[model samples]
Target chain A: MTVPALSVQGLTTHFFTRAGVVKAVDGVSFDLAQGEIMGLVGESGSGKTVTGFSLLGLVDPPGRIVEGSIKLNGTELTTLSGSALRARRGREISMIFQDPIATLNPLLTIGQQMQLAIAAHERLGKRAALARCTELLTQVGIPSAEARLRAYPHEFSGGMRQRVAIAIALLHRPAVLVADEPTTALDVSIQAQILLQMRELAAETGTAMIWISHDLAVVSSLATKLAVMYAGKIVEQGPTAALLRDPRHPYTAGLIASLPAMTTPGTPLTQIRGTTPSLLSLPPGCPFAPRCDKQTEACVQKPAMTLDGPRGWRCFHPVGQTAGAPT
Target chain B: MLGFIIQRFIQAVGVMAVMSVIVFFGVYAIGNPIDIVIPPDATQEIRLEAIRRLGLDRPLYEQYFTFLANLLQGDLGRSFVYNMPVLELIGGRLPATLELVLISVISATVLGVSLGIYAGYRPDSWVSKTIMAVSVLGFSVPSFWVGLILILFFAVHLGWLPAGGRGDTVMIWGVAWSFPTLNGLSHIALPAVNLALFKLAMMIRLARAGTREIMLTDTIKFARAAGLSEATILRRHLLKLISIPIITVFGLELGSTLAFAVVTETIFSWPGVGKLIIDSIAVLDRPVMVAYLILVAFLFVTINFVIDLVFALIDPRVRDGASA
Candidate 1:
């Protein structure tokens, strides 16, 4: 269907470590239709950012995409050469880093930084490139962007810098934007503002987004579809409302329950016991079985994703009786 | 910024003050001038009178004040050995020394930085390995030794240029704009090259290290992912990050070049402050000796300040902070 704006199938990324080969992304798969926002939600080390970095070919040595078909608009990105991948990045498929401070070059003025990104993908002269830089900055809701162009990264407050970074990423109007924890480092108020700006921009540009975060609330607010990952696999995924309304994986229930809410204050918050297992020593059965509250004998040998109803789940006895209002 | 400048100037003064003390004592520390002037047997009263007239009988502090006053007034006192104004003696030799140091600094900075960027960009490659090999060679060999070897092979043996002296005596100021000598440059050239060789190695090594560090930065990796060309990456991103360390090392190298000029000047028989100080000290020409010592100290401080400015220009953080 319209080649899905982005399609990932049987995607796996592994890291060869002294301990062992860690399967960080064990055959995780998903799709994002054009203009769709896909929320890839997980706690730390769930391979969410890794997956995003992989899509843009940002994974460095030691960690590699061993098996995967990452296609954007039907053009395969996984197999692209280094130069070709770079050309696509920030131009056709850009990334907004979790800590924008780390993402931006501190030495250059915003204008120079934006011009560099624009020049990397476009054939325009510096004068034209600067004009477009101001336009993008203005589009991202940065006031007085023309004057701000001369200001370096350090001068801009944290939220402002992230906006400038976002402006730079959108300078060439990429089709896909991968935002990795774009709000995690910001103050709550600033985070809300930046997120709002991003949502508006996504709508205005019709950019397909892979929003990666541990905060399901934030994701649910922005993404129509959601994938919950544990250890290194997507244990459950479906339409955001359906998954939130009736999460089918015990771990998914634990995550949703753990989220702060008005209704759950009196109900002792549910927590998935134990940490996500180390990838090197992942249980032979389901990676989350050691921590899954609904584990059984069938969980000892890993339950493969079974198509049940409208979503996918990797549980022998899938979670039943979704959250209901006792009307 | 005013505070920084004032502080730096105070530090410079302190250095000059110490250098003056050492110059004053050490320059006059040797045996009395009478021994060399009159066969060591001049009548005691005559020698005493000579000393008194020359103000040698004054207390050390008084003599120091006199020397300071003379220096402030641009009269570097008198060179007892040269029998001329101390300022004139240094003035005569200053150009030769400046020329040598300029050539050496330029050579080391260009060669060292180029080699460093290349080695860093191609670590473990044959080109990098070759550069490392050459750097090791350049580092271990002493500059004087390098000079000797150059003289032996290129000058004495090959006879391409004059073996010594600022060219033949005939060419000395024969033309208003002409330099020390045609033959003399062959000698000066080797010595200058020798002086710069160590700095070349240092620059390359430091540059390579800094470049490698810069290369590891996420922004650089991001730049690479964004499809920047290798040339653009190296020139715009790589070089800027390494400028601070390179400038730092280069400043130190420049200071050492001033210090080492004495040795190089002696080797080539070029009349620079290095040789001027030595010749003054040999016969206890205290004024010229003090002048040259203070001059070298001044050169070191001034060069370091300029290097700081260069570093600030390269790193915006520093520049903004300093300006702020």
Candidate 2:
């Protein structure tokens, strides 16, 4: 097997709130190899986003990695201090925020903002940083990067601003890029353009990527491997093609069926029946059992992720034709 | 830009006209100058003669036009109290006040901004907390109260410095080779500090809010991700974000500072326009009061104009709005 570029072992994050402790990402684990795009697919409360944040140590106050081991190229990240982790961030890894508007400062000129970006890690002269900023802006397909440099955030359209943000993330050329739904906020056409550019950039840079999204359609098109998360745990993991063609877990099967498939054009789309279990008060047994069609009475005892044949899944009983059922 | 300026000029003229009318009627319509200066026992004839002397008995419109015409010629009527040309009296006191105001604003901006940046970057630290607490106390307590506190402890109790005044007239100017300039500066420092600390509190609170909000943005996080040193981000990002708000507050505050200077100038016995305006108020020297008010109003209007111009220069979006 190819050595994984990143391995998240027994990764867990919990939050203490007024209600109770939230197991946002409970014992989640996955691996990504070099130059491979891993899709982390889940619903809003499934902890997919939280898992990505944990890998980067970007979880804000009150939410923390309670138990986990994140090894980025075999180096433990959980032990890194704030300064050390910051050093690792742009040099080795970068994350794209969900909202482009909330990301760029409204008051600053794009050139000045980009200058800070380049000068942050390198001790280059002002002119050199400016030159690099122009290069990166141009690389991200901004029209007239030179003229656009002097423009403020409000001056640009939403698509253009997101492009600028993408340039900022790519300027340092980090080894691993975590895009938490980068194109989720854009219009359909702009979304396609941005995703195409992102895919091209990833291939060119040969960077390992974790594309976190709720829409299976977007990730299935871009990622080489797919990991389906239920509640706070990974319910299934396999090659993207295999998972899409033959999902091993009932939850994953439900997810595939829910998509608006061309093969069943007139038929009503399949969507998971029940709500995701709350991390704060998860039901004993499989978190997805309440929503699972093939769950058994034994599912109430709780099931741990177990390997089924060649894939991994966390289900007490599979969908008969599927493998990797949790036991 | 030229069009924006012309628009502002028109607005300034209208505002000044309205303000002048209020000053004229607010002071004149309240009571007779004769009743104020002479006894209530005085006869109507005496009051009428007093009113005629002050040019209050003329047709209201004629009086206004004559006042406006004289204003065009820089001739405000003679002060009833000072018994001198209103313009000339202002000229005499103006330099002292101008000097005090310039000193206060300069000192306040430097001290306030430096402290504000420090307080903003480390909100949770003791340095930030202490500054925040001090800022609250500084804002709530009156400027004059702080002035009294300084004079009591430093000038009276400690005897570490001279109490007040610009200086003995002999030492006012002339050749200062040694610490003479230093001594003059030392004399101004107490009152200047008194003026500055309160304004400092205001700027600090403003900066803290601006910085906190800026810090939350993606750009700040992106900059940090670049592994750029904290100092670099502060110098480049934090300060730049701060300039827009600081410049805005500075412009408006610059205008009001002239008005506030009166209070500070009076407390420390520092000679400035503020003190001159106050003296003119005590005697109902209407013309002098009117001239000073107009002079102050003029300064405010010009400062605002310049501020808008700067906003246009730094940001193009403002340019469009200013024209519109």
Instruction: Write down the worst ten-residue block by lDDT for model 1 chain A.
Output: A318-327
- In angstroms, the error of model 2 at B235 is 3.1
TM-score of each: 0.88, 0.89
Strongest candidate by TM-score: 2
Q: Which stretches of candidate 2 lie over 4 Å from their true place?
A: A1-3, A16-20, A125-131, A262-268, A308-310, A321-327, B35-54, B102-121, B168-180
Evaluate residue B286 in candidate 1 and report its C-alpha lDDT on the 0 to 100 scale.
63
Please, what are the lDDT tens digits per residue for candidate 2 over residues B1-324? Answer: 788888889999999999888877776775555656666898988888888877887987788788999988878878888788987777766656655566777667777777887887777789999989999998899888888889999999998766677763322343212123566666777877887777788888888888887776766766665566678778777887777788888877767876658767777887766887788777666787778888878888888888888888766567666676
TM-score of chain A of each: 0.94, 0.94
Docking class of 2: acceptable
DockQ (C-alpha) of model 2? 0.45
- The prediction achieving the highest DockQ against the true structure is 1
Per-residue C-alpha lDDT of model 1 across residues B1-324, encoded as one tens digit per residue: 676667778988898888888877776776566456444777888888878877889997899899888877877787666678877777776666767787888888998899899998778689999999999998898777787787788877988765455654332443211145565455567777877888888888998888877877767766664566678878877777778777777788777666557777787776666787777667766666677777777878888778877766667777778767
State the fraction of real interface contacts model 1 keeps.
0.44
Q: What TM-score does model 1 achieve against the real structure? A: 0.88
